[model samples]
Target: MPLCSGYMAPEYAMDGLFSTKSDVFSFGVLVLEIVSGKKNRGFYNSDHELNLLGYAWKLWREGKGTELLDKSMGDVCSVHEVLRCLHVGLLCVQERGEDRPTMTSVVLMLSSESASLPQPKLPGFCMGWNPNETDSSSSKHDESFTVNQVTVTMLNAR
Candidate 1:
């Protein structure tokens, strides 16, 4: 199976499990990226080394969720709607698969303005990885391969 580490849920990354909830988690990442106009992978913040999700979570907790909106939008969208979408995005990226909302629930949450949203827990895969940990793996091996013309790079447990 083909995999991109950025969108993989913690359970799938660590345990090789995939399910609807995993899809939901990916969707959540997509939503945050869309709102912030940033990629979840390789996202950089000067103040912290957090990924896009962690940065979004931090902004949301600090009551600065509006700061996450793509500035180029220039008031073209409703602030309420944008924040609502961000809230739903956070809900979908909760650390535990079971804590994530189903796609059905996601649709309803996005469409309903009056409905209340629950607080989001810590998101999965939000921490930065160590750059110098080559010897951490028990096995000593080096291999290279490619899929669909894309070269396989480093592999790490996120």
Candidate 2:
């Protein structure tokens, strides 16, 4: 799938540099989005301007991470499993690419219940649109981006 530039790692977003770690960062964002059933972009909270990552981080830090789960999936999933996924997702979106786990590590972390995962620092692009800014018409600090569509297909081996 072709993701918007919003999912790009901070280094790649700012410096046009990308690597495997960038992919890790994107994966982390995906994981968080999935767990929350929310898109990283176009997500708005009445309480604050926090995007999905910021909101998730806040909840996790406040010992209310379970509230981040999508209510539609109520009673259909394991709280422990969901929290684990949330943790793994946060780890993947760490501000520094090097802080993110490799794909191999991600797989293991997701699959192992006993794995000791490290706490994630603030994620890249955690801030959302700040409505308090008076310069809405100015594009100088605009984070607005155009979406590009790309289709991906995977063939299964029998």
Error of 1 at 41 (Å): 0.7
1-158 per-residue lDDT for model 1 (tens digits): 11225888989998999989999999999999999999887675665457788888999999999999999998899999999999999998888999999999999999999999999999998764333334334235564323466677998998
lDDT of 2 by residue, 1-158 (tens): 11224588988987888989899989988888888899888675666567888888889899999999999999999999999999999998888888888999999999999989998898887776644545545556555664689999999999
Error of 2 at 92 (Å): 0.4
Cα shift from native, residue 69, model 1 (Å): 0.8
lDDT score, residue 53, model 2?
83
Worst 10 residues of 1 by lDDT: 130-139
Q: Candidate 2: TM-score?
A: 0.79
Candidate 1 ranges beyond 4 A from true positions: 1-4, 129-158
Give me candidate 1's TM-score against the actual structure.
Answer: 0.78
